[model samples]
Target chain A: MIAYRPREVIIEAESWKDPATAGILRNLPGIPRRTVADAGRISASRDTLILARYRGKFLKQCQGSGAEMCCNYFTASYAWNCHFECTYCVLQSYLSGSAIVICTNIEDFLEEIGRTLGRNPDRFFRIGTGELADSLALDPITGYSRRVVPFFASLPNGILELKTKSDQVANLEGLGHGGRTVVSWSMNSRRIRRSEEGGSSTLEERLAAADRCRRWGYRLGFHFDPIVHYDGWEEEYRDVVRQIFSVVDPGDVAWISLGALRFTPHLRERLIERHPGSRLPWGEFVPGHHGKLRYFRLVREEIYRKMNAWISDCAPGVEVYLCMESRLVWERSLGVAVRDAGHLSDRLDAAATGGA
Target chain B: MNITDMPIRDIDTANEECRISGELEAPALVRSLRDIGQLNPVVLLERGGRRIIVCGFRRIHAARTLGRESVPARVLGPADFSPLHPLEFALRDNLAFRPLEPLERARALDKLEEAGLLPETIVRVYLPLLGLPPRADILESQLLVARARPGLHHCLAGGILTQQSVEALARMPPESQDRFALLMERIRLSASLQRQVLGLLRDLAAGDGASWGAPLDGEEVGAILDDPSLSPAAKGEGLHEALYRRRHPRLTRARARFRERERALGLPGAIRLAAHPYFETADIRVEFSAPDAARFRFLAGELERAARGADLETLFEVDE
Candidate 1:
């Protein structure tokens, strides 16, 4: 993965007083810092970093369209935007600007999560920090996992899942996460990783990192998301599944997810403009619920069923789930469907915690 | 600049000084010239010992039609103006009266380029002045339309073929363009329909890795064109539907299966069931009309019974 080096840094007046902010600034010594007033003039040059104090509630539900079944996971947004440029990233259309933003108020974000978890002590919470940005991409510089991993370790019922495509797991090596942190990687076939996922870590690098995390007393997870379908996809994905099981023990693996490529209608034009030669947008699609364009139902079913079969063959008794798919699709592909979002959430919680 | 009266015969209208050629007479402008004398003087430049009218071709033509021997003119030496000044002046002067047709805009851009202006320069300077997007693709499309054959140019200029349609047509080979022109002339499709048909054709050709003329060679397309009983609108509708079905076979099959399931359910006329689009969700909407409470209860009971049938379950199945 490409390292993030902000050409310019903007700090809010309030955030400038925080010790974490000062440490971050001191780590990248000699980089200039500006106040929030200069935000309009900073030009958002793709390398600019804005460390503003986020005022909203940091812990929120993933914005899932009710048109499909949601995994019902909570998102802890400490950052926005990513350094790596995946051709089909949703942020290209969701974000209004291109600058990378990291909230310097880590204490306040943790306090909100602690309060929410304390209030619901009886219920298990599966919270993740990778919804809006790569969870561990900037951890080497910020050392945020040092703070967040221990925080979740102290929790009685909360699990923190640090998901990323980068192999930046060095900071997480010595953290006493008490089997609470599930270090996962967003993976795809080598063909897709080479063409679509520019500036991301290689598949072998990510699997090695996952093995290292497992050795460090952390449960491991894998997400085969945005699974692009192309010629010879069966062999491509089967090889990926085989490689995954060969490295890590199935007992240490918590959950594996499969999500086919899906995007909103407007992202098509943006993908074409940003990545001119991308063949991802030329697939036959139909307008799905919530105005998103999805592959034909048969294509999606075939991909999902084949992937589920391959994963099951490689690692028996490993729980495989579909991300943001419909009830009918779950039934047709995996032969099972949780009743609702809450049921799905419970199932994932049980899988992650090993039915504690 | 000197104001003089140059004879209509001496002003060389046949040279390459002006590339804009068409009906130069506007009846309203002619009537205005007759009611009140000429308001703007014609702009002329001296080149190769011949005076050429640069700005006011229409005004000069109007004067000639009025049987006037000479008209008021502003004369300039060739050194006083740059090569782009004539096209710039003509484009700017005519823009004030009315919007330029697509062909006219294309020709103006082409003429500017032919005068040694870079595409970037035209995109940055002239596109905004002519109310076009300042993008290289737009300039390329306009130049393509300008360089097409005269019949296609006429169609483009007359608003029969839209900008998008012409751009799609411009991507095809000349032979394909000729065939498409003949089809378009026979069908006389509206501009929006023309764009839709051409867009579908382009997608089909790209998906098949064949030429744009491949889809047009089908017997069904030819029969639609040859059928005398169908109206032009009907023919266009049939052709577009056929092309769409061919382009998206999976979606077409899914919809057909859904419709078949819908018909097999044998629901009442007052009730309707619509499957969720693309089967992205397993949702089925049941709509019905009831005039009174008794009828509403009856319809509700009928729906409750119909919902228990296996056919209704099949209707909501994901086929794609």
Candidate 2:
């Protein structure tokens, strides 16, 4: 009954001092204090709060463990903290503190990325900043995405994705980013965005922002993650499809990801404690191969059928893919289970090269 | 015929052996035998005194339908084969199938255990198709056999509870499940009892209806469910009975005002029934006409309030 405010949030990280992290820092725009340092080649910002600088080095060292390519398509932004309080968020578990973070080591970071890209000169490298922090959420205060867009525009074999739940696209207007960059928004049905996501843009705001990106010649993508299964989900999702069609043409969309509600068992308690009266039970589930709770095959197939069918009707011919789905599911539900599915790199490569 | 290479004898046949003619049969049995083959064999014991079947009752029936002379038989103690322990052997044989029906499997396990087979061996040698790992498989199977044999069958066939529901049930302590079962039984026994149980469970499950978001105490809930009202509709009527109508006059007036606004807006009356307060923001306006945009904003605002208010503690009913 009382107005709520968060208190004592935990932030966490492992292997935080990554070279790829520097590229994220160098490309960040609108940071209060920004300088291209040559000594140590690491840019430092005094205006921002530095919570922690992780020195550990390891690959794909986080929860939701999987093979390299799928997990590491984008390097860690080293920036953490999300303003939108989505109930089923990994960052809530991953972070050790609640304070906003700004990593300041761009010069060396970009240089390291340059070196890595140079070694594999013929191959394209896809990196993203949205993993640790919302890609565009902090753009107004931090201008991180704007900075990265230009750096990506100049690299021939590099692609950047700035994903967010925010409609803050004004930051992109001044940046002369070509089609080399992607501006993506995570979407859900109106009901979910209302019931689950807090401090995030509504679906219409997101789609409208996507339209703006397309007009600006930027590729757009959508992620329907943590797609909670409840009563009338089919009709609810179809309604979302109708909305998507009402806003933007399908041709401008690069990809769309459909992910079901999945999380560690421990979160069930957290969710029960946090979001009461939440009607999230679809009553069909099994422990997944990854050891997280997942929908039963039948329930999962039902979700896939409902979602894929809606996508086919509304955005025909657009690249529709599943996020972190198993092969058994891929074949039964979508009828497209490629071997390299569980890997994001494989999916990314397929997207880049236009492979189905 | 190198029958030693066979996985087992009579995978899809009855346990007891009997005489059968290939010419006579029922349509369902005929179909099963057609796919799986005749299972029961006539056992010939002790210097081959007489060819008689020790097991495979369904196979014998099917064989009689097909006019076949002999069916596959597992010879037992006559020295090596015995026909005296018909019921025990019948139970053991039925338990061998990977997809044994739940009721039959439970009854068989009960019989097998009484026949001196250790619980662990039955788990290893018997219950593989139950989809449980070796140790857990045994324990869950035994629990299934014990608590709700018929229900477990439906569950295993993926017919009753969804995987999601099972996961939820698995988290609860076994004693809690037992309590839930007892409660369900109480409701099922009588219509009057059912109404009382529904009201009690509803109130209990509502987690105090926005009152500090605490689940009702289990003892209090059980008492409410067990309480007998004057009539069947008595408990149901209590829900519509306004609480503190005289004391919270302003609360009632605000509700009436909201109802009038809702009617004017052409929204369903059901929206007013929510226990928690809800408000929607303007629907993230797309290119829309003024009227549609206004409606969208009103709906979105109401929805925004609902979303902001939802927290985990508010959703789940932790029965004390």
Q: Going through the candidates in order, what is the number of backbone clashes in each?
A: 2, 72
Show where candidate 1 strays beyond 4 Å: A1-16, A21-37, A45-52, A119-123, B1-6, B15-48, B59-153, B164-183, B186-232, B260-274, B281-320
Error of 2 at B29 (Å): 70
Task: Give the per-residue lDDT digits (tens) of candidate 1, residues B1-320.
Answer: 57888888888977654646455867777888889989888888787898887788888878878888999899877667665477677677778877876677888899989877888999999999889999998899888887776667666766667767776776667888787777767676777778678867866776666787789889988899889998877888888878878867787888899888887867777888887666666678889989999999998988887778877778767564
Give Cα-based local distance difference scores for all models.
0.82, 0.54
**Candidate 2 lDDT tens digits, B89-129:** 45454445434544444445555565566778667755553
Looking at the true structure's interface, with contacts defined as alpha carbon pairs within 8 Å between chains A and B, what fraction does model 1 recover?
Answer: 0.52
TM-score of chain B of each: 0.81, 0.36
Q: Model 2 - which docking category?
A: incorrect
Ten residues in sequence with the least summed lDDT for candidate 1 chain B: B14-23
Error of 2 at A227 (Å): 0.8
The regions of model 2 sitting more than 4 angstroms off are A1-72, A281-283, A341-347, A350-356, B1-320
Chain A TM-score values, per prediction: 0.96, 0.79
Reference contacts reproduced by model 2: 0.00
lDDT of 2 by residue, A1-356 (tens): 01112232111232134443344344443444323222122322312334234443311223434621133354557466676767777666656654556554444455566667778788667676787778776666445565677877777777777788988888797677756787788888888888878878888788888888888878787788878776777788788878887887887777787888887666654666677665552233445645676665456666887788889888888877776665555666687656662355556655643452
How many angstroms is residue A251 displaced in model 2 relative to the true structure, after the best TM-score fit? Answer: 1.3
